[model samples]
Every structure is written in structure tokens, then in C-alpha cells.
Target: MTSQEIFAQIKKKASFLCVGLDPDPQRIPKHLLKEKDPVLTFNKIIIDHTIDHAVAYKPNLAFYEAMGPAGLETLAKTLEYLPEEVFTIADAKRGDIGNTSRLYAKAFFEQMNFDAITVAPYMGEDSVGPFLAFDGKWVILLALTSNQGSQDFQLIENKEGKPLYASVLEKSKTWGTTENMMYVVGATRGESIAEVRKLVPEHFLLVPGVGAQGGSLEEVAKYGMNNQCGLLVNSSRGILYASAEKDFGEAAKKEALALQTDMAQLLDSYCK
Candidate 1:
């Protein structure tokens, strides 16, 4: 989907919520384990229940990759099942040499047909450029992440006195326009989001680390939002594992609805 289309969906749904479909078989309700393909079944239920409240669905590739061949098959099926109008992100975080990166882009954009794919910029533009070559597909580069380890490299200042992530945001703009490029600014780094916004005011941000990660939705919206309501705040465990019973889907829907309602109000307050 193009950036315009994604923003349109957010307006239509009154939401910019992106549900993370990171299902851990062990954490899912035990009742679902009895199914032939429990992970797939669990994902379908979550999607069905939360689709109305989310504009995007992100399936972290690790969850499916860990399941081996069957896991990959399940991911393929899940992608096919997702509603076409809703954006899809393959949080694969793949980055390598130029040739390898090209193949990775084709894998997700052509083979899998994901609307976007999370990419690592550690290898510079060569690693991320191939993904941007695909028209209408997005490259969500890792910027200031929420994890504890992000302090190790992302925050390190170079001789120019700029943090590594700041350079990533600055240099990457030349590689792709706001229409096809986005940055992953974690929700826990809420206070710094304004700084990020100043660097790339028109680009979108795919923010994780809310809910189960204890990031504040209000703080993120306050600092990160732009005229387009440029944020896709994700909630994974908090919504996915809301319950461990047969009513888990209903519980997930409730969590999503709560987030979507907050997002709707934020959109009205900020975008209007």
C-alpha cells in the first residue's frame, strides 16, 4: 500500500493501531494447542477479532521461523488470510550485502506480498536500498528502539557529536522518500520522538513497546504525532495474550478497541 492509502485507512477506521501477531505457542491458550495448526488458528482468531480496530497487522518473523518449516508455511497462510485493505508488515529486520538484501526484499515484497518490512541499517544504504526499490512497499528502518541494548549502539555519539540513530535518520532520507520509508521509533523512547519528528516530519513511524512493554500511549502520541497522525503504535502481548481461555479472541478484541478509541481521540485532537 502507498502511504496515502495507509493514512486513508487510519482516517476511515479512526485508528492507527497495528496489532502485532507474535504468537508464542506456549503462551497461547491451551485449548488452541489441540488444533492441528495451533499457531495459525490462534493468529486467525486474533486477526478476526481485532481487524475492525487495527489498520495494520505485523507478524514478527521470528515467531513463525522458530516453528521450522511448518512455521514458515503457517506464516504464508496467515499472510494470505489477512484483509487486503489493512497494511501488513513482516517484522523480519533483514539486512545484509546488496545482493542478499535484494533477495530479502523480493522475498517479502514479491513472494510474501507484505506492505512493509522492518530493516536494519547497520550495513548502510546498500542493505536498505534494495527494499526501497519496490514501488509501494515500505522500508521501516530501525532507529531508536525501546530495548535495553539500544543504548549500546544507537545512542553512541560519533566525532560529529550526533547520535548514531540521528545519522541514520538524516542519511536515510536520501535513499527513499517519506512515501516509501519509515523509521521504527520505539514507544518507550517517547520523550525523544519529538526529536525524531523534527528530522523527518513527513515520514511515518512504526512504534512498538507499548502495553506489555509499559510504554505510555499518551506520551508517544504527544511527541510523535504529525499532521497525518504519523504513528502505527503496536501492542503485541498485552492484546494477544489478554486471556488464556477459550474467550481469548474476545479479550484481544477488547484490548484493541481500548487502544483504537484512544487513537481516534488523538487523531481528532491532533490531525484536526
Candidate 2:
């Protein structure tokens, strides 16, 4: 989806929530195992329960890939089942040589038809540019992540006195316009979001580390939001895995509604 389309959905739904589908068979209710495809079955329920309260759904590829060939088949089926209007992301974090990058783009954008894919920019523009070549799709590059290990490199200052992520934001912004490109700015780095915003004021940010990871929703919105309400705060473990019992879907819905309500209030305050 284009930037305008994405913003429109945010307004229409009163939300900027992205529900992460990092399903774990062990964590899911055992009763679901009786279903034909338990992973897909679990996802379908979660989607049905939370779709109204969320504007996007991200399926982390690793969770499915770990399940082996059966895992991949489940991922494909999960993609097919997602609502077309809801923005979809394959959290593959893939980056490779140009030729391989093109194939990765084709797999997610063509075969599975995801709206976006998270990419790693460690390989530079050529690795990321192939994904940008596909019109109407998005490349969400890793910037300042929320993980403990982000300080290893992303926070390191180069000889130019700029943090590695700052350089990344500046250089990679040229790869695509705000419409087709976004950066993954973890919500735990909330205080620094304003600094990043000054670097690329128009781009959207796919923020993780919100609920389960302890990132503040209010702080992220305060520092990261632009005229378009440019933030997609994700809550995975907090929402989807809210319950491992039969009430899983209902529990997920409640958590999503609470976040959606908060987002509506945030949007209203900003739109004013």
C-alpha cells in the first residue's frame, strides 16, 4: 500500500497497531493441534478476533521457517488467509547480494503478495534496492532496534561522529520515497525517535518493543509521529499469546482493543 493509503487506514480504523504473528506451536493451546493446520487455524482465529482493532499484521518468518517444510507451507497459507485491506508484513529481515535480493522480493511481493518485508541494510543499497524496485511494495529497513545487542553496532559512533543508525537513516532514505520505504525504530529507543524524525520527517516507522518488550506507546507517539501519524507500533507476545487457553482469541481482542483505543486518542490529539 502507498503512504496515503496507509495513513487513510490509520484514520479509518483509529489505529496504528500491527499485530505480530510469531506463532509458536508449543505456546498455542493444545486443543488447536486437532485442527487440519494448527498454525493457520491459530492465526485465523487471532486475525478474526483482532482485525477490527489493528491496521496491520506481521508474520515473523523465522517462527514458520523453524517448523521446516511444513512451517513454510503454513506461512504461505497464513498469508493467503490475511485480509487484503490489512497491511501485511513478512518479518523476514532478509538481505543478500542483488540477484538473491530480487528473488526474495519476488517471493514475498509476488508469490505470497505481502505489502511489505523487513530488510537488513548491512549489505548497503544494492541489497535493499531490489526490494524497492517493486512498485507499491515497501522495504522496512532495520535502524535503531530495541534489542540489548543493538548497542554493539547501531549505537556506535563512526569517525564522522554520527551513530551508525543515523548514518543508515541518512543514506538509505535516498533508496525510496516515504511511500515505499520505512525504518524499524524500536519503541524502547523512544527518546531518540525525535532525532531520527528530524533525519527523515516523512517516512513511517515500524516500531517493535512496545508491549511485551517494555516500550512506551505514548513516548513513541510523542517523539516519532509526523503529520501522517507515522508509526506502526507492534505488540506480539502481549497480544497474540495473551492466553494459551481456549480464550486465546478473546484475550487477544481485549489487548488489541486497549491499544486501538490508546491510538485513537493519540491520533485525535495529533490531528487537532
Candidate 3:
């Protein structure tokens, strides 16, 4: 989807919440294992329950890839089942040579039809350029992540005295416009979101460290929000694993509603 379309959905839903579908078989409710495909069944239930409160759904590729072919099939079916109006993201974090990158883009954008894919920029423009070539699709490049290890490389200063992530943001802008590009600024890096916003004010950000990861939603909205409410804050374990019983879906919805309510309030206060 284009930036305009995504922003429109954000307005329509009064939400920028992106539900992360990172299902772990071991963590899924035991009752679901009786189904034909427990993982797929669990996902459908979550989607059905939380669709109204979310404008996006991101399925981290690792979860499905670990399950092998059956897991991949589940992902395909899950994508097909999602509401077309809600933006979809394949959290694949793929980056490779030009030829391989093109294939990765085709797999997610053409075959699976995801609205966006998370990409790594370590290989520079050639690795990311192919993904940018696709129309109406997005490349969510990793910038300042929330993980403990991010400081190992992303925060390192370059010769110009700029952090490596700052250079990544500055240089990658030339590869794609704000319309088709975004940065993954983790909510854990609360202060860095403001720093990233100054570099690319109009671009969207897919933030993924709230809830289970303990990133402050209020702090994220305060420092990261722009005119378009440029944030897709994600919650995986906190929402998905809210309960281990048969009411799992309902529990998930409750968690999502809580986040959506806060988001609506933030939008009213900031976007208005």
C-alpha cells in the first residue's frame, strides 16, 4: 500500500497498531493442537478477534520458517485470510546481492502480496534498491533497533562523527522516497525515535518493542509521532499470549483494545 493509503487507514481506524503474529507452537494454547493445523487456526482466531483494533498485522518470518513447509503454507493461508484494507508486513529482514534481493522482493510483494517487508541495509543500496523498485510496496529498513546488541554497531560513530544508523538514514533516503520507504525505530530506543524523525520527518516508522518488551507507548508517541501519526507500534507476546486458555482470542482482543484506546487518545491530542 502507498503511504497515503496507509495513513488513511490509520485515520479511519484511529489506530497505528500493528499486531505481531509471531506464533510459537509451544506457546500456543494446547487446545488448539487438536485442529488440522494448530498454528493456522491460532492465527485466524487472533486476526478475527483483533482486526478491528489494528491497522496492520506483521507475521515474523522466523516463526513460520521454523515450521518448514507446513509453516509456510500456514503463512500463505493467513495472508490470504487477512483483511485487504489492513496493511501486512513480512518481517523477513532480508538483504542480499542485487539478484537475490530482487527475488526476495518478488516473493513477498508478488507471490505472497505483502504490503511491506523489513530489510537490512548493511549491504548498502544494491541490496535494498531492488526492493524499492516494486511499486506500491514498502522497504522498512532497520535503523536504531531496541535489542541490547544494537549498540555494537548501530551506535558506533563513523569518521564524520555521526552514528552508523544516522548515516544509514541519511544515505538510504536517496534510494526511495518517504512514500515507499520507512525505518524501524524500536520503541525501546525512545530518544532515538526523535533523532530519527528529524532526519526523515515524513517517513513512517515500524516500532516493535512495546508491551512485552516494556517500551513506553506514551514516550514513543510523544517523540516519534509526526503529522501523519507516523508510527506502527507492534505488540507480539504481550497480546498473543495474553492467555493460554480457550479464551485466548478474547484475551488477545482485550490487550489490543487497551493499546488501541491509548493510541486513539494520542492521535486526538497530537494529530488534531
Candidate 4:
């Protein structure tokens, strides 16, 4: 979707929430497992339940890739089932040389038709530029992530004292405009968000590490929000895996609604 379309959805739904679909087969409800494709069954139900409460859906590709062909089939089916109006992300942190990157872009944008894809920027411009060639699709570059090991590289100070992640933001912004580019700023890095925002004030941020990861939602919104509500706060385990019981979908929807309600309040303040 285009930036205008994305912002419109955020306004219409009163939500910037992105529900992460990191489904674990073992954790799925036994009743769902009885179906031929339990993962898709779980995703379809969850999508139906939370569609109105969220503006985006991110399916972590690793989770499905591990399940092999059947898992991939489920992933494809899940994509087909999602509503066209909502943004869809393949949380596949793919980055390669120019040729391979082009194929990766085709895989998600043309074949899978995901609205966005998570991209690792370690290989520099060529690894990410191919994905930017597609119009109306997003490349969510990994910056300071929520993981503990992120400090090993992302936090390292350069000769001029800028953090490695800061440099990544500065250098990569030229590869794509706000319409096709976004950076992943972990919710756990609440204080650093102000710094990251300065680097690319208008670009959308796909923020994970909330919910189960214990990142504070209020802190992220307070420091990270822009006039357009330029934040897609994500919750995975804390929402989708809220319950492994038969009522899992209902429970997931309840958790998502709570986040959406909180997001509505934040958006009101920003959009004012």
C-alpha cells in the first residue's frame, strides 16, 4: 500500500497495531490441529477476530519455513485469507547481493503480495535497494532491535561517536523515500527513539518488542509518535499465544482490542 493509503487506514481504524503471526504448531489448540492445515486454521481465526482492531499483520517467515512445505502452504493460504485493506508484512529479514535481493522482492511483492517485508541492512545498499524498486511496498530495515545481543553491533560507537544503528539510519534513508522505507525501532529502546526519529522524522517505524517482550507501550508512543501516527506497534506472543485453549482466537482479539484502544488515545493526541 502507498503511504497515503497506510495513513488512511490508521485514521479509519484508530489503530497502528500490527499483530505478529509467529505460530507454533505445538502451541496450537488441539481442536485446530484436527484440521488438515492447523496453522492456517489458527491464523484465519485470529485474522477474523482481530482484523478490525489492527492495521497490519506480520507473519514471521522462519516459523513457517521450519515447518517445510506444509508450513509454506499454510503461509500462502493465510496471506490469501487476509483482507486487502489491511497491511501485510512477511517478517522475513532477507538481504542478499543485488540479484538475490531482486528475487526476494519478487517473492514477497509479486508472488506473496505482502505490503512489506523486514530487511537486514548489514550488506549495505545493494542488499536492500532491489526491494525499493517496487512501488507502494515497504522495506522495514532492522536498526536497533529488541534482542539482547543487539548491543554487540548496533550500539557500537563510530569514529565520530554515532552509534552503528544511527549510521545505518542515516546512510540507508537515501536508498528509499518515506513512501517505501521504514526502520524497525524496538519498543524496548524507548529513550533512543527520539534520536532515531531525528534521523528520519517522517518515515514510518515498525516497532516490535512490546507485549511479551515487556516493552512499555506508553513510552514508545510518547517518544516515537509523529503527526501521522507513524508507528506500527506490534505484539506477538502476548496476543496470539494468549491462550492455547479452544477460545484462543477470542482471547487474542481481546488482547488486540486493548492495544487498539490504547493506540486510539495516542493517535488522538498526535493527530490533534
Q: Per-residue lDDT for 38-131 in model 3, tens only?
A: 9999999999999999999999999999999888899999999998999999999999999999999999999999999999999999999999
Which portions of model 4 show Cα errors greater than 4 Å? Answer: none
Clashes of each: 0, 0, 0, 0
Q: Quote model 2's TM-score.
A: 0.98
Candidate 4 per-residue lDDT over residues 77-142, each given as its tens digit: 999999899999999999999999999999999999999999999999999999999988999999
Residue 218 local lDDT, model 4: 86
Please give the CA lDDT of all the candidate structures.
0.92, 0.92, 0.93, 0.92
Candidate 1, residues 20-118: lDDT per residue as tens digits?
999998899999888999999999999999999999999999999999989989999999999899999999999999999999999999999999999
- Cα-lDDT of candidate 2: 0.92
| lDDT for model 3 | 0.93
- Model 2 misplaced regions, further than 4 Å: none
Return the TM-score for each candidate structure: 0.98, 0.98, 0.99, 0.98
Per-candidate alpha-carbon RMSD to the true structure: 0.8, 0.9, 0.8, 0.8
CA lDDT of 44 in candidate 4?
91
What is the alpha-carbon lDDT of model 1 when measured against the actual structure?
Answer: 0.92
Output the worst ten-in-a-row residue range by lDDT, candidate 3.
185-194
Model 1, residue pairs in steric clash: none
